[model samples]
Target: MRFLPILLSAAILAAPASAALKDEAGITEGLIVVGIAYEISRVCPDIDARRLRGLSYLLSLKSAARQMGYSPAEIEAFIDDKAEKRKLEAVARDRLAGMGAVRGDVAGHCAVGRTEVARDTNIGRLLAPR
Candidate 1:
């Protein structure tokens, strides 16, 4: 899968809404491309791109949440919720002091890595494996 579409989508999202008619299509297409690329890479380690790209995406989300005035308690709630889904997200508050440096796309890389791990072993297998 190609990721050009994802980057294109980001560009379209960056564009003004009034002038988005033509660019919207490309943006949509780019996102699809990026998603496909991400999935393909997740299934095949040999093709996975650098993990940093995914890390950047995660950081962006955290930044957005911060801008939205999420309180410390609120952020703690979020961390608690995410901890069940991802162990690393449950890091101690003290350890998170410098977590601002963590990129957003780290989630993507984590997802891909998890997928690869699941594929290689039954570590995360449910009651049954389909």
Candidate 2:
């Protein structure tokens, strides 16, 4: 019975801090682009790079928007915004190229079989569309 009060107090204290962090750390369009670019640069081979980059960007944006408390409608609206998408795509492209230059054969090192890459990095799971 005594432990119950302590637990409740702890929960109360933790809740506001978590809420504050969520509010402050809302996902940005730039972040979604860079995240997708980074993930694709790490895992995808050059042969499949363009397709994987597009898919990864959409997945990352959806996941990040949901995490930041955006509603489905809002997410759809954001997706529909062509200007935003174009900007993000340009940023993603640049970041991907930069990563390629710096990493020097990222795909050669990291692009194992899909099953192996999935098992090793868990990136397949993270970037999968929900």
Candidate 3:
């Protein structure tokens, strides 16, 4: 009987983890992180260089996101949506940079820190695998 309580608690905890993501929108944060990692790879062919830059960029973005009024959930959704739409990344990047090559639509709205995070991550080390 004592174990019943423990089992119930475990089930409750696990339920949220298992069901946290019911759709693509639910997992956007992860997508953003992954996309940043990919961008890092593209920028730096060397692992060591990418690792430091990627970590710094991620740290800055996370801090900025917290300061910005976006819940972690919203950031994730935005990242996922952008990653899924290939053109969105390019458009968003230009918009954020203010180069205006693309319309000030996607990037304009992106938090500057978030855009920097994507642009700054270096993935050469990430691709090499420890």
Which lDDT values do the candidates have, in the order given? 0.34, 0.40, 0.35
Candidate 3, residue 120: the lDDT equals 52
Relative to the unseen true structure, what is the Cα RMSD of model 2?
Answer: 15.9
Task: Decide which is better by lDDT, 1 or 2.
Answer: 2
Compose the digit string of candidate 3's lDDT tens values, residues 28-118. Answer: 3332343434433333333212344444554555445556555555544433432233533443343334532123333332233343444
How should the candidates be ordered by lDDT, best one leading? 2, 3, 1
lDDT (10s digit) by residue, model 1, range 1-130: 2223343233222311222121333322322323433443444334554334543543444355456565434433443332221322222111222322122344543454455446742111211112
The prediction achieving the highest TM-score against the true structure is 2
Evaluate candidate 3 by giving its C-alpha RMSD to the native, one decimal: 14.5
Which runs of model 2 end up more than 4 angstroms from their true locations? Answer: 1-64, 101-130
Candidate 2 — worst ten consecutive residues by lDDT sum? Answer: 1-10
lDDT of 1 at 4: 30
Tell me the lDDT of model 2 at 82: 47
**TM-score, one value per model:** 0.31, 0.37, 0.32
